[model samples]
Target: MSEKTSASRRAFLRTGLAGGLAAGGAALAAGAARADDPLITDLEAQPWTQYLGDGVDAAPYGLPSEHEAHVVRRNVAWLTADPVSSVNFTPLHELEGIITPNGLCFERHHGGVAQIAPSEWRLMINGLVERQLVFTLGDIMRFPRVTRAHFLECAANSGMEWRGAQLNGVQYTHGMIHNVMYTGVPLRHLLEEAGLKGSAQWLLPEGGDAAGMTRSLPLEKALDDCLIATHMNGERLRPEQGYPARLVVPGWEGNMWVKWIRRIEVGDRPWHHREETSKYTDLMADGTARRFTWEMDVKSVVTNPSPQAPITHGHGPTVLSGIAWSGRGAIREVHVTTDGGINWHQARIEGPSLDKSMHRFVYEFDWDGAPLLVQSRAVDSAGFVQPTKNALRKVRGVNSIYHNNGIQTWAISSEGEAENVEIS
Candidate 1:
């Protein structure tokens, strides 16, 4: 090598062997420590492996790594009166790719987990239906089935933050959500089988679980791409995630998913159930409640560089990746900010960019060993931009819990750790 080139290489190692740093740290360290160290010329390396003798031989079904054992579905200690009425949040900060494992899907029951046997399960259509029909699990399956991926998010997500970022981590502020592919017969198919009468304008879906959770859906939505899903992420549903069956309301809040789904009643008007009336209403600053706020607005948050997940790897070229989505339509833009949301930069989104599905985006930048306030913004195909915390609070007061999809920010320390914060 030329003398200047050799000198520059030595300087680069002195500062930090950054690129492929996770793999090249030792290579550079060896050169500075010992002259006889072998150079690492090969660009590729073998993945770490544990032979059969290392652990259990096998399982009827596989699971995530034990290293991921810390990841779990969490519940707010005092959100509700009991478990059935409480909410369990998905560990969004801990996940990477889409497709939440069925076991990890967040649970929010009005009563408690239901013990329903598929043999006894029956879905009945009544009320304004031209032909009232009750179908067994097998009968429902006899019809055609379709598989699609979608995200289920509780409207109350980040609600605690409205009062002033009460929660410390994204796991708490933004974990009441999950994205998974469902395999099941579409709700439209079942509705068609029942044959809705001309008078039918609304539908109420009830769950079989102890709480008997229920919600009213507009007839237009009932027949539009809804699914009575029996499987999540390519497997039978988990007990906590609505075993046997659950409703999948695409581009809508999770509460409407109606886990342990059991019955559908066609109606002429909204049933105005407790969930739609007193619970899900978004009380505004003037004391007026914005009821029936079903569509979750476009929201985005930096998953990593947050309280639970920190930038453990310091300096050099770092990848800032996060999740973004819109209920109105497909996400069109997701901006990132190294210095909070003051000046934003476009992120490089990777993976599938489907309509009404989660889109993963990444931003690469050089970390200069300084404190940073990282944030993300999502814009939908409808040209609607995600609202700021203040903008949302200006309308919906801090007392409200549902339909708050404000942009979230993460503060990164010089030590490389991250914490959730609000940045104007």
Candidate 2:
């Protein structure tokens, strides 16, 4: 190393440092200029500023910001024949945190969302109960009210991918679920009001929709944590949801949470309804079907790097985030695998960690523009670990369409786009 070469290198380093400092100073100056001469600097001159704001009665019913118009329930046209007797998925990718907003929550109706007036709603307890009693909306509201948060997940949440990765977005694959704080009277109180007959072992809750959806719930569950909810999140239940009142079976299949609940008929046996018999049941390849599978297994999905939400920032510090939940209990932990299933890392679970509620989890890492396979695995408090598609298939078979809690895999290309992929 000659002195002349060393001097030249030293001079280059000094020039580079000065240039960098000057660029940073220029950025600061630009920021200061923007602060001084902001787009809204002359607020008084603007139309909104010049005119008085709309009066309190302008919008009697409040609505979300116009910018949030995209955040709403979406339905797959091909999935069902008619919109009336169909399902709409929640916009999970557009949502954050645990609670699913009332309007944004997914809607599934056998016949259609019944538009029943609160004043006209009536709940009747009959069948095996000692006394057959009918309680109006006012009468039911008189009972002790309690608020609880729980996730109501459809049994067929990820059923489309049970055979393979068919869906393109998180909303299609995992949006048939929602968590909300329900304010209502405990179902036990109502059952106690109409003393349960000793022979009562099952309770069949029937909806008031045109199709009259009905499902047989176990007596133990009815007496435990079930609720007859009237409000969701902080507002009255949406029309799509069971407005006025709906049965809430926490930590169970969403179907069992009968919306527009009208009747609770206690019985000694489970009614093999069309829902439980021909539909929700998981059929095996061996010609046998799993029945009464109400509880949703532990599951999680990476919402950020999913197909709908691709990585756009290029290589650097990246946050991989998603939600995990269980029908059994609170999510104990969530694991993320960036290099496929070969390597696994524990994700940080952010909470309120309420029982049977959605939990957010995040895994941060440095990406270097590498093509990768991203996946998330959840473990519930019941110690049930989420299984892979292959593992789930080996046990339940490919014919089964429900309870697909398989670890979802998202393949990220070198260009930073992501797609749903099934890996061996």
Give the TM-score comparing model 2 with the true structure, all chains together.
0.88
Q: Pick the candidate with the highest lDDT.
A: 2
Question: Candidate 2: lDDT of 298?
Answer: 93
Evaluate all candidate structures by whole-model CA lDDT and list the values in order.
0.80, 0.87
Q: Which residue runs of candidate 2 sit more than 4 Å off their true CA positions?
A: 1-58
For model 2, residues 287-395, the per-residue Cα lDDT tens digits are: 9998999898899999888776666556778889899999899999999998899989999998689898999999999999899999999999999999999999998
Give the worst 10-residue stretch by lDDT in candidate 1.
43-52
1-424, model 1: which lDDT tens digit per residue? 5798547535533322343355455555655665432334333332233222435657546777886776888888798887757888877777776667677777777778888899988888888877898999899779899998888888888888887766656778888888888898989999888888898999999998777888999989878889999988888877777778889899998889998888999999998998888888888778888888898889988887676666656677788878988888888999998887679999977888877788888898999989998889899999999988888888767878777788787778886656566765
